[model samples]
Target: MLIFTNNLSENRNVFIIFLLLFYSCQGEAENKLLEVIKVKELKIKPEVLTIPNPPYVHLIESDSGQYLFYLNPNSKSLQFMNMEDGKVANEIILEYDGPNSMSRRSGIAGLENDKVWTTFRPHAIAYFNYKAEIQFKKDIPSGEVDITYVGSSFQKGLHQYGDKVFGMQPLFMNHHGMNKDDIQKHSLVYSYDMVSDQTKWYDVYYAKDYWDSGKKLSNFSWVRREDKLYIAPWYDHEIQVFDMQKEQVTIKVEAKSDHINSFYYVNEIPGTHEEGLLNILNNDLYGIILYDKYRDCFYRFFYPGFTDDEEYAIDKLWMLRNSRPFTGVMVLDKDLNIIGEHIFDKFQVHASSNVFVGEEGLYLSLNNENSPDYDEDHLRYMVVQFEVGE
Candidate 1:
């Protein structure tokens, strides 16, 4: 849509780059990314899902087959539905009352080779067989530092490769606060050798001057493809890559959100409980970076933040204290270059617990609390189908 003169001034070119960056950020990055990035809505329908609970889903490949799992609060167990048939595939019923009980709030880390790993709040990891039996559980291992949180959910949890179990050690800070140097020193990734009972922590932390207080805007999600692990922190405007083969944090790509125009932060620890809750709600965050294995590309989801008095911010506080900011997606290629971005209108699609990627395209929950199509029995998804250019 833009045509330059045969020769243009340097200042003029620099000014135009930020708006249409594909042509100007760098010569190599000009890959016709914006021109080709297209998306349209699609409906999977209730018939395709046939799911028991709502969709706060995690896709996993077990020894038997591929399945989508969600925490069924009504049944008090993880219900795995067959991805192909949409029927009940398997269930992991953990006992919270028995001698070897699991946490009532057991978080799904990851499942591999019929072995499912679950984590507790403060710090704990337990391995469960497909038959709903705990093989072994471990608390925070004896360490030199204070690790209040040891594990994460979905793809960021315990990854078993070779003889070791690799996992995250995200730094969830306390009320006292931490300095920049101390925050940088804390390793956020670790690997445990199951055979030797030894652990190794990787030297990776928050980006320089990246954290506001380390408490708020600290949730992160990741996706591992082959030897490269892609990490998307809650606050950073960049994607950090950890090369498992190299055994070090390698490259970082600057994949900033175009639609999150006004970004906010919870800088100081709030005095009151309600004050802290307000700060948490009134902020923007990068969430759940997902990799589409079929397409060999990545999608980084985000919530464009708004103020307390914004027109479409729902109620005064909002949704059981969980702020439902309008969702957006940044599309990228496997090499980590920003291709295009889709910006949804306010109250269009809900955040987090709803968005996911599939073979067809990125699936977004159309069941917005404010939408007229919202219902209890039938949940719907707006499949962002990518289209080819003429």
Candidate 2:
């Protein structure tokens, strides 16, 4: 009887051990199910040599690997680099002090047809080739539906729908405050056909009550996902999504913040491909959110600045919010939940400056006040680097 009792006790102990092992393994598997992303720092040097300026880079397909074209529209020049050898291939000036003079503020677009196009303020569109040879120059018509005194907020231009290329024109004027003057100034959207080189303009709208309430047509804050364009009309609490093919405003997303100034589409890389992140910068402390379009989930990130959210002269600040300037490499995905945020709260960065993401890493150019090339009061650019995850 004693031996039988000892056997039963040993069996019960063995069963308890088995249960614990199974639960432990199950917990680990559940933890692994969550998405994980890491943000690291990278060191990258310009392949082509040039004075460290606000640079925009494009990867051109070459016979070998690829050639990265660093177009500095600010300086009106092109900096070409061979990606294979990590060396500067060539640097050519895109602008010339001809009989006509021009002032450009970073609207350079590299098309697939081996052409680079840029607009210099109120009225000039210039096109050049890989060799920096002038192909064509065009002027914006002085008479265009009578909305003059428009201070240019030249955002990105170049809308690509499948095989077709479309140029985007933003006729957005600046208004400091929500005043009566803002109601008079309207924002216009224009599409330039890349093949035929034809320009067409469209009037964007929000709610009728908002429009009648003295709200302005201000969609300079634009971003593209696939072929569709998402624009945030200043002063409106909603973001309107436009379908390029249908030529219609299809979707309107209600923003959590009152002032929806800017919106960025979080692109997919690896672990977080299923869910996308959308960043909307507003006047309040609630800045951005990770939005899962598929699952219909929202995750928010809150970081604030000391001063008002000012977009201008950002490339000029040495320390942002009294801290060392930092750059965001990639969005993070932690256990099916998206995390990780590096804010401009530390340093100011301009949306106009050239922002490039490559196989090497993410590169940013902030306006540096400490540089001797420009006076401390003047605007100068400083380049910085950040690493990405696989």
Candidate 3:
């Protein structure tokens, strides 16, 4: 009886210590303030490009910083622009059938070796050279493994290292059939080898069963540096680092926010297209991650959730117009330690579609159609340049 009582007392003391440390860490995170060192605005005149529909833009800078490549992915075409002069340099009209045809027009994964690679709708990968010529096309091999949950889209964070490309692969047993076991089995990253024409899967660390219970879908944002691939799941506060050589998750960075809720399983919010929009607005963590080679750090960008008084009811259009207008960015060092967190006011800079970390500074693209400057005749965007400082 005496020994049992002593053991219980020791355990209680340890538990108390753990709680104190956990709360201390959380307090530090809550109090940490992100300071904006500087901000610059650049206006992009859209008339210089030729595309019927609005294009999804990605900024890629050359190593020498002399040229900036603007990869514009449209529904039926992929256009390349030189940001130096805001002019279309080359373009490829994507087709469904032909020698250089794609299964479907998706988005560009990443650019390397002067070639832009895209994830074809359903299950394929295609590469286009600088001259907008299709150079390589191959279907990603799934073998007997089921990949139906991914539907026809690939999540952001397409990365190229040597002869291989890495991106997220969502695994599900159908939305209606998912359970805790299925969610625990979710592996959200995959690699495609250009030479072998094969696809391989990598497992994420700290598998939390939020998706299975909530009937929610999963999305990911990624950043690749050298031999490491950094992955951030849309709904979770953690950022995972996967080592390419080991083919395993080697590090996990958790950046907890006081405004966000801990993992919980609510009944899947269901609607038409509005359902997808609602889920993202309610559940997403920092949705995109960018590596700043110049700053030797990483930036994770995401929308903060709405307040209770805002409105209990919302639709696709309503959410778009009234949802939290501002977005937050969390900066981290190479080790993924949280250096700071900052918010960009919507009035000064509304939601940013894409963020590029450059030697000059951080460039953000405000691509929303609802922007005050958005004009049908011109491709209007307010580009904000941020300089990180002490």
Candidate 4:
């Protein structure tokens, strides 16, 4: 009996040891899969420019790297700065009423052929030349017969392709008397032809799924690389890339994430605008996708969730400040295969702006004013540069 008892005890000890070894190996494999890339700081000349509320600053680097366009939406002005010394070359005041007036909220689309384009809410696209002169303004008509049902498109998703600009209308109309079926049938994407002065719609099926699932219309981003345009819905794990010439979705890439599938269903919430905002604030996985032409890769700036705690997630201010630390960036090759994933540390980068990939390296805005590393005198706008890793 004593020998039998001794053998049983020995077996139990061995099983416990096996479990520990297995778990330790599993942890190590996960760490190896997502190697944290290193960031190299490059200090721009101090006092070159003062950007108030740095988080709202939108930067567009000229193709020749000779100029930098700073779009300050808060100040309703666009400052053209010399890249060499950061001196203000020119300034264009974006106002509401005048010959040079544009929608104050109309965010910049991008720089193309020495011209900057900005999109006015609902249906206007304004173009400004390098000298800050308004070249022309185009109004895009919503093809919907029910003008009342027509919804606004997102400014960030606006892109100039060839002789036309491509943008997507909101999935659902927030106005009263709108039903689910009406919202689902709304046009997904629109292209305004500069030559014809006509708006055409493209058939994208997943866009219907967005309205059906009650996702917010503003939670989308666009990236154009050469002839291809990539559209990613912030709440969804998939990215659809359309061929500009064909005007059809040629490829669809789905990213793998454990937290993506854990989304809280919008169907459970009431269909009010307030409820929709609450749903997104509490449960959506927000992300932006950008194409890196220099490296021939795509980088996704993803925030899986605001917080694990349900109570803390409801606090708007707390959610905004802490969400950046939890943000993770995933790099994918041109083929859409994920190469690596890196979770940025607190104060390492800000999640407010889009990731800027330039010839120098990857750049991210920094706004942690409380950090010991923060320098107020020299740096009005802090930017961190990271070297891409294999």
Candidate No. with top TM-score: 1
Across 1-390, the per-residue lDDT of candidate 4 in tens digits comes to 001012445533553453355345444233113444333454444224454223223445665554455664445566655645656667766556777666443456666566776666555777788656788777667666332322222225567678887776544444234545565456557788888888887765354454455534435666777887777766677788878788888998876544454454544446664455454445646576767655566777766544445343234444354434456677665666555566666555655462466544356655443244555433233232222232
RMSD of 4: 12.1
Candidate 1, which ten residues in sequence have the lowest lDDT sum? Answer: 29-38
Q: What's the CA error at residue 294 for candidate 3, in Å? A: 0.5
Q: Is candidate 2 or candidate 3 better by TM-score?
A: 3
Instruction: Please list the residue runs of candidate 3 whose C-alpha ends up more than 4 Å from where it truly belongs after superposition.
Output: 1-31, 49-56, 60-76, 93-96, 143-145, 149-155, 171-173, 194-198, 209-216, 262-266, 269-284, 307-324, 347-352, 367-390
- What overall lDDT, based on C-alpha atoms, would model 3 receive against the true structure? 0.57
Write candidate 1's Cα lDDT for 1-390 as tens digits. 332222335323642453355434556432332322224453433323333225347756647775667766666676776655556667777678675476643477776677778776677777778767888666656244577666566746677677766778765454246655666666777777778877777887768766554533455788888877887887777778988777788998777776544444556756866565565556666777888765666878877665555433335455523425466677676777775666576666665665666544566766666555655555455656432121
Q: Candidates' lDDT values, in order?
A: 0.62, 0.41, 0.57, 0.56
Error of 4 at 200 (Å): 0.3
Give the lowest summed-lDDT range of ten residues in model 3.
1-10
Q: After superposition, how far is residue 337 of candidate 3 from its true place, in Å?
A: 0.8
User: Best to worst by lDDT, what's the order?
Assistant: 1, 3, 4, 2
What's the TM-score of every candidate structure? Answer: 0.78, 0.53, 0.76, 0.73
Q: Residue 3 of model 2: what lDDT?
A: 10
Q: Where does candidate 3 clash, by residue pair?
A: 46-379
Better by TM-score, candidate 4 or 3 = 3
Best by lDDT: 1
What clash count does candidate 2 reach?
Answer: 6
